[model samples]
Target: MNFKHMTAAAVFAGLIAGCNVMGTPLPDPRLSGRDAEFMALAPQARVNSQFERYLVDYKTNEPVGSIIVDNNAKFLYYVMPGGKAVRYGVATGQDAMAFTGRAYVGGMQEWPRWIPPKDMLERWPHLQPTADAGGLPGGPDNPLGSRALYLYQDGKDTLYRIHGTNEPDKIGQAVSSGCIRMRDIDAIDLYNRVKVGTKVVVL
Candidate 1:
């Protein structure tokens, strides 16, 4: 077996085991520095078993190191070198607001600041104060959570992001203005693996 598959094989059992275990308290991820500072104060939520992180056989034509977001399935997959993927449950944009098509990761940040777009402020006027204030500062309370991957298309900002969310319980559901939301742990994991210019497909 190739090195990638060999690594996948080594972790497959453990990840699957993680997906099946229930009623047991999930352990906090080992984080350091700023990550530790925020997550320690971030509200903890119980993620359902099926939505928990997992490793599974994945067959796709996309090249290795690509990302695929399946909104209907409420999962985001990072394609591994082998025919395998690490899947993480996500909360996607609502039907009308969902973004579909291809984009590239243009930028990334840890604990990114969130500026409510004009459209979002129009939809919820209560957010006007936040927009006036130049956006919320990055921290535990920020909806962008602990990490964010800014999406761009044709050298222009897509005005969308694949970002971490403070609300972990919202995973496996379709309920967001437009940005794709992931749990902090999953976001940090994905951020570590992806880089600027990474391809992403939303379906």
Candidate 2:
């Protein structure tokens, strides 16, 4: 090709190389154990590349260490000490059940059990048997994948959670019962950064 054409193509490639492109499902050495679990789970689906975790510049009036869920954007930001945040892709609640406004992380659990709430059982009656059986035990098969941070307001359970998901591909979508779903490793990472009573704002 002509020299001018080659120069233009090189510029375009440089632009792409300079952009922030995150990879999905993480390749952290620590997650090697979970790789086996993932393989055993349902067939994996492709997550939108943009949904991957990122450290970005964020301007917010909220204080440091706060958790903010921008439901419209399908992103949950853990505000850092400065004007920065660690953002993670999330699957939010459907329109009829989405939780908005503010709440606190009232409780946290690792590898939490899956209890089909009464309302959920009402919608999915087949879950009644599981509910009657007193919920599914925590493990690889549980829907609350690796951890859970229970949201609460006014000292009452909001029946919503920010938890790990077995379906990472659902990130950047609206399909959950009401909880915020993150990739398993993302949940674990966020769990470590958060403590009970951390403020959570859903917008």
TM-score of each: 0.86, 0.86
Provide the clash count, candidate 1.
0
lDDT of 1: 0.88
Give the worst 10-residue stretch by lDDT in candidate 2: 20-29
Q: Where does candidate 2 stray beyond 4 Å?
A: 1-6, 17-43
* Residue pairs with backbone overlap in model 1: none
Q: Write the per-residue lDDT of candidate 2 for residues 1-203, one digit (tens) a residue.
A: 24465677787777666664542233322544654465356335667766777777789999898999999999999998768888888999998889999999999998889989988888899999898888998776689988899999999999999998877778999999889998877887898889998999999
What tens-digit string does per-residue lDDT give for candidate 1 at 1-203?
24455677677876767665432223435799999999889867988776777766789999999999999999898998779787888999999999999999999999999999989888899999888899999999999999999999999999999999988889988899889999998899889889999999999
Q: Return the TM-score for candidate 1, rounded to 2 decimals.
A: 0.86
Cα error of candidate 2 at position 13, Å:
2.8
